[model samples]
Target: MKKNTLTFIFAVGALIFFSQLSAQENPLSVGFKAGTGLSNYRLSGDMKSFTSKMSIGGSVGGFVKYDLSSNFALQSGIDLYYSTSKLDSKVDKSSNKLKSLGVEIPLYGIVQGKLGSGKAFIGAGPYVGYGISMKSNGVNLFKNSNEAGKLVMNRFDYGLGGIAGYDFDKNWQINASYQLGIADLLKGKGGSMKNHGISVGIAYKF
Candidate 1:
């Protein structure tokens, strides 16, 4: 009877050691994700009176994440975003429309917690963007001008963002996030641009 008990203990120790080794062998995970993003720009201070409306547009991007532990990781990616807004002037009788194209890069560190069958994660990071092009369309509201030139927006912008996501398994996830701009995208000091959106996509771990 004593010999049988000693053998059982030895078997349990071996099982635990092998399980730990298997986990270490698969520590790194990589995946691809793409989804639609809704973007809008907000004006600040006195500029709010002139541009009361915010623009809404779509964005898509791909990302790569490296797992640092079971509950933490670091991720980085690139995205293309489009946005448009309408400006109505109370003083003038007409309105103007603006469209902008932007490229953004984000670096984030994430912390995760497991809940039943799904895992939830939260992340915060900084992002930088460059405006590639901008155009204005509409009737000229300025009193002296018959036509308006193409809109020139600030090329460089920076912001902070927060993200929350849930993973159903190792290969699938959905997320929602908010981003606030700290730098002005418009050439002058008129206003700063802000964006918020939700996205759902599939991720494959390798």
Candidate 2:
């Protein structure tokens, strides 16, 4: 687990470095995005005593995108994201809305084409997020364990995600994105968990 986390961090640094080198030759754009995110955990492995609820959160980030061609480009950025969900434990007769804060590295492959007065585009790629903190009803839940049934949270996560948006003009755009979490976020034994996050919002280019 430590190796994986270190590798992920190294990869993020390498990507940003390469993007910087490419910026000199390619048409590059720097942008900021802000939006609302909806997250839900898919539970598995005999969840006979728990109930799950969807959480709504917010996301804000900046990105650097380099155009490889008129129709293709690559974008990567750092984002701070948040999520909170209610977990009901029937066995313990307890319930709490757990909140988590995390940072993400998003790499997107963008495809573009011209539309009436603007551009229409779509992108798909991968993302890695690391948990910074977690709390349930204001109590810390970070046990730093990945074993099942420990009721602890995992700090590392990686997944495939995609984005689609419309560039209204050169400086502004509207977009929607989704992440299909491929990692197990729960380290406890009773069940496994996968996260699904969706968001919609606006972006600005500079």
Candidate maximizing lDDT: 2
Q: Write the per-residue lDDT of candidate 1 for residues 1-206, one digit (tens) a residue.
A: 99999999999988876665566546556666555555555666544555536556666677877666667778888878776667665665456776667788888889988987989999999989887766666322212343343234567778888888888887788777677778765543545444434444445454
Ten contiguous residues minimizing lDDT sum, candidate 2:
142-151
lDDT, candidate 1, residue 70? 69
- In the predicted model 2, the residue pairs found to clash are 147-187, 148-188, 148-189, 149-188, 149-189, 150-188
Over the full model, what C-alpha lDDT does candidate 1 score relative to the true structure?
0.67
Per residue, candidate 2 scores C-alpha lDDT tens digits across 1-206 of 99999999999999976675666554789999999978877778766467777889988999898887677889899999888777777788787787989999989999998999999999999999999998875556676544444467788999999999998988899999999999988775667878788999899997
Q: All candidates' TM-scores? A: 0.71, 0.80
TM-score of 2: 0.80
| CA lDDT scores, all candidates in order | 0.67, 0.84
122: Cα error in model 1, Å: 0.9
